[model samples]
Target: MSHTLDTYRLLGRSGLRVSPLALGAATFGTEWGWGAEQDEARKLFDLYVERGGNFIDTAGTYTNGTSERLLGRFARDRRESLVLATKYTTLRRPGDPNSGGPHRKSLFASVEASLRQLNTDYLDLLYLHVWDFTTPVEEILRGMDDLVRQGKVLYVAISNAPAWQVSRMQAIADLRGWSPLVALEIEYNLIERAGERDLIPMAREMGLGVIPYSPLAGGVLTGKYSRADLTATPTGTDDGTRKRFNLGVGAVTARALEIAEVVKEVATELGRTPAQVGLAWTLRNPGVTAPIIGARTPAQLEDNLGALEVDFTARQLARLDEAGAIRLGFPHDMLASDRMRAETRGDLKIEARQ
Candidate 1:
């Protein structure tokens, strides 16, 4: 079945009803050199809300706090009706070690700053933006539980952390009666399926909803980039930051462009845009609670929203999967091997559990 902005789904094990797709506020400010200005950002917010979208994702450090500030203004009247989520853990000062980390001081400080910028009394959701690796898991979970007790945060989540670490943290939270993570956010797209190896499955098993960012692979899956375009310089109309970022992460590989070609082919076959096909592919995953959509213009936002209406046939879905498939590596491949499965099951036809 197809979904829409109003097709609310429970986020993870929580009762929080969020849209199937989330409107990312990272593009709400132009201080980053590639985001929308105030006027255009307002239009994006209005359009999404008018269409019944209720979940909004932002970070305290996004666009130097301008993203959250503008979102505060735009969502003021509808603040209660929307689920406002923001992240912490990014460095706020150049030399201060305490300025950023998953530690208690950084977490509390960041939440206070976000509340001020968002012009709100409390946040609906708070994510530990990234794992600092130095703080103990107990410290992070205890801090989050304190925030929830204080009514400053409704829910706590994590992003960009190792699967093992997140799993351990969740276990600790459960044991200590602290607030558990209800969501896991990561960079997931056709070109970046590394999350599938462990993070995706871990979230599903741990009852944490998977929220994928960069669902379009930094616009590569939109079929707008080509090998020839790789050498081109950024113009006023185009932002080179994403391309450079993609390059740095090795997301702009030759194989990625090849997968984008398949996306384009499927779009042509289904009479949909590549963006819609690319996003629909992600939405088809049952593990995915939502994929954050970012846009610098209303036209792009409209185009991305159309993804909710696109559905692929069995063949098209298989083709897209084949084009972007990655090796599971290590135990995954070993467990899925025919000999191992036969030994594990032993001819008894048992209903497999997810």
Candidate 2:
């Protein structure tokens, strides 16, 4: 069951092929106060590409744009061989009203900025970074289609959008013959299984591949944190380390620590790092196409890559699932109830399609 970086998989319904784990470039610059510098970033990029990884994920505002710049420099020679994916919709100029959002103006402007920063004529994949909820779906879809027709972007995808909105957009694209969203990037990890209620299921039916971010639960599932971290206080500052940021964002909660402990036990049983076990759990999901791995150092990156080789026993999988299980909520729970199933299908046993 072990696979290497070159063990490429098709991205959703598209003909495009990418690595099982995308190299996240958000850690490519130190402008964020907690990432790798130029030389170190180059080493990370080289290490991934040398191992046959082609999917590189970034955003326009990551590290105040330094992330994309470094990726641009490091990927210059192998640009054609790599799939450079960048996102938009984050406000670049704080005071500018038209600098951000999911509207046409912001879409076009952001694509242009991403293209310039990536140092490529055309982006292999472009994602709408965040949903503003104010813009109409038609406007967003049309603008993305226009970019595709203009040869500025090869594929269009989305991240951090509601399930209903994404499915509606997919329907609109299908009806109007626009560029359909091929991938969905969301925060999914052992600690964050909320996506399981709808997002993951919707993507499976809609033909969009699920690309999970924060598979380590912001490093909580990596077992580097202890219950003591739950009591840690944050130092409010513009420039902060990831640990401080995690504390501020409530990512170091007692419940999260408990899950990490279970992950640690499972990792011990499997003779692997908790980081690898956490990542492998995400990879095991049938709906996930790839999980984005962000590492500030080459050593971290190497340890994360070991996830592809870590397999689990049924008991181990069950333990991990029980540790981080979430309720499907509302209609899902109602629809899956025994009474509903009995009413819908009595004693007849029917095989469901896979």
Candidate 3:
């Protein structure tokens, strides 16, 4: 049997609605150790599409562009029906100066190259992969707007940028009436809630869709690493990701398992898995539009997709929220206080928590 989501969700706060969950085909080549081969990648893609996932996300840096190439072939026949999104500005080449960064020239060339690789005339969504500190805000916005005018890009978005930078970029776009970032992508998971600081509020106010990548906290949420101290070297195996990603278990790895215990108990109560709880946590955040699901196999994709079946009660949510919550700092923390709420609502009646 296959798992299916209940309904589609709008991207960001935009009118464009897509599958509540999306497929991330970054593991489509031999670049990464555990990456699924083209044939297996195709199967995973098919599984996702069959389960009603219409949105797909990828980037140029993935497997030296083979990921996009494979996706291009698999998506060809159904290009018009799928919400295809890709990113640029990671690395131009081995040592090319203009090869990477969010510079206008780099962004422009990346889009054109991506268009050729994907075999699509226009991308449903295009992301400025990661922020390059040197690139000017206006240059990025104008270059992207030019693509929209040229019919090469439908929607412009961003990934791995700070809240202040996004805010400034949007203000510039507003002044120029250019195509702005409609979405923001970050590495968010039960082990990583840093985006709640400025990113979430910025997204909420700007009407931007928040699509977090690495929602599994680099596989800690899977509960496999819990059996090991993980203080040793990351295991080396064709199916192993840690060694290849060059990361050992993090300091938060223990915390991830502690949360996993609650997740397992909850899953036992609901007959689900910890992986489902991790995914649901990301999906349930208020400003979250979608969490990109990366899978190296059809079975993994199917399992992650089952996250849609996991639900949390108010009490359950409170438990996980407090467990993983990060400090928002300064004004944000001040604004969330009961004292502030009372003052902000002076003479108005409001409901209190139980």
* Residue lDDT tens for model 3, 1-354: 113543677776567877777788788887866688889989998888887789899987788889888999999988998999999999859799788889888888898888888888899999998887888788889999999899999998999989999988987887889987788988888878888888987887886888989887766676655546546555566554543362443533566768767766666777777778888888877668889897877787878988887778898888878877778888988997989988898779768632
TM-score of 2: 0.97
Which portions of model 3 miss their true places by more than 4 Å? 1-6, 235-246, 249-252, 338-354
Q: After aligning candidate 3 to the native by TM-score, how far in Å is the CA of 314 from where it should be? A: 2.0
Tell me the RMSD of model 1 versus the true structure: 1.8
C-alpha RMSD values across all candidates = 1.8, 1.4, 3.1
lDDT of 1 at 219: 86
lDDT of each: 0.91, 0.91, 0.81
Worst ten in a row by lDDT for model 2: 234-243
Predicted candidate 1 versus true structure: per-residue lDDT over 114-137, tens digit per residue = 999999999999999999789988
Off by over 4 Å in 1: 231-250
lDDT of 2 by residue, 1-354 (tens): 328888888888899999999999998887866788899999999998988899999999999999999999999998999999999999989999799988999999998898888888999999999998899989999999999999999999999999999999999999999999999999999999999999999998998999999999878888888878878787766353478778878999888999999999999988999999999999877779999997888998999999999889999999999999998889999999999989998899889878
C-alpha lDDT of candidate 2 relative to the true structure:
0.91
TM-score of each: 0.96, 0.97, 0.92
